[model samples]
Target: MTDVTLIFADLAGAAPLVMVLLGAAVFAMSRVSHDPRRMVRVLIAIGILLFVRLSFPLVIPLLLNDVIGAREVQVRVLWNALFYSVPNSIALGLLFWTIFDVGRARSAEEMTRA
Candidate 1:
């Protein structure tokens, strides 16, 4: 492997550790939270992130070779798209969910106070 590939492998190897740390933090926070459903959402988000992280190693190797057919190329393209889109979609979903959740909680607090 070249220097860049070695660096890439090292970084990829660390992805799981980062994910686990994130999971641990989420677990700790969820324990203190009153809403169990929030914990569920967070777990789901973490699962999605883990899936994307694990798929990273396979994606490059799977797409690196030459393709001889239109169908094969299309299939590879779809896999690449799926791999890339999943993480992005999860992130956007979490972003919106967090914003909406915070807004709803604030509104509820104000209503209760009033």
Candidate 2:
């Protein structure tokens, strides 16, 4: 395979390990009964963030090669900013909200040991 393919291959190869790590994170989060709803929100949002990151190297290259008209780097850049960055930013925002939840200080208090 070509070098470009190798690069994507590397990303694909590492995906399973990353997925396992994320799965462990989700499992750990599941054990937290103090704030199940918010904890799930945090995990789901983080998982989306990770999924988008993982899909990018594999999907964008393929899209540029066969599906999309634009070239690889340029189109992926614009697409990254549009499709990828948006959701990524939103995921981060949701994660922040789920963790802090300014309007729900009482819920945050449930997490305290005191």
- Cα displacement (angstroms), candidate 1, residue 45, comes to 0.5
Give per-residue lDDT, candidate 2, residue 52: 78
- The list of candidate 1 runs beyond 4 A from truth reads 1-13, 16-33, 63-82, 102-114
- Report clash pairs, candidate 2: none
Candidates in order have lDDT scores of: 0.61, 0.71
TM-score of 1: 0.51
Per-residue CA lDDT of model 1 for 27-60, tens digit only, reads: 7475745555665666666666665665555544
> Cα deviation in Å at residue 70, candidate 2?
0.2
Looking at model 1, report the run of 10 residues with the lowest lDDT sum: 62-71
The C-alpha local distance difference test score for the whole of candidate 2 amounts to: 0.71
